[model samples]
Target: MNFVHNITAIFIFAPFLAFIILLFLSRKKLKRGAIGFSADITTFLLFLSVPVSVEALWGVNISFAVSVTAILMAMILLVLEWKKTKEIEILKYVRKTWRLYFLLLAAGYVIIWLTGLALTVISF
Candidate 1:
């Protein structure tokens, strides 16, 4: 159970790790489009993990409904990012505004985390 909890913690914090990596890369002079695309992939993966965590820790007290909501939003964002990646203007804009990408990702992560934590505690 401790192992499972550790794994869940890792899954939960993975987005923050990705955000830090993206931030560091951007600071190191990576291309904007590349950074934006990377951030998109990272964020999508982060959202995808929510469902997996819920399922794997089924008996654990976590906000399953919130995880579902995050997954839905994640899918939508993934599609939008995919489409944006195909358009020159949008891709350029995304690349140039990579920091905004990080900020959005951070915001999403915090919201989902807090919502799940709150709901889980309340369930008990």
Candidate 2:
């Protein structure tokens, strides 16, 4: 249990490592390995962002903040899709939502890392 907990903590702290590992591990098994593991990588990044934000003094319980943001974006995208196409396609919308959510979380994580570095350097 402790080993699993520690491994989880390490992955959350260094998420790129997890992504790299996944890419390599999946490459042989998956035809489009890197793309195939995107959702999994996004999840690792989302979890990473929550802790990074908290440590950077950006927000508390940031997973809730991001989850709401992702859902809101998904709803807005779905509405736009409905308006443009005159119908809602669940599977397509879900893929778009996943990509959107991944981009959002990745950007947030980078911002948090920069802010954390700045905080450390300036003692603020």
* Candidate with the greatest lDDT versus the true structure: 2
What digit string (tens of lDDT, one per residue) describes model 2 on residues 19-107?
A: 77888777877858566484556565665555566754755666666667767887899889999999778987787777776666667
Against the hidden true structure, what lDDT does model 1 obtain?
0.59
Number of clashes found in candidate 1? 1
Superposed on all Cα atoms, the candidates' RMSDs to the truth, in angstroms, are 7.6, 2.4
The best candidate in terms of TM-score: 2
User: Residue 32 in candidate 1 has what lDDT?
Assistant: 57
Query: Residue 104 of candidate 1: its Cα lDDT?
Result: 55
Q: Could you give candidate 1's per-residue lDDT for residues 13-119 as a string of tens digits?
A: 56557556666777556665555655665655555555455555454434566556546765666577668776546554544344444455567556656777788
lDDT values of the candidates? 0.59, 0.72
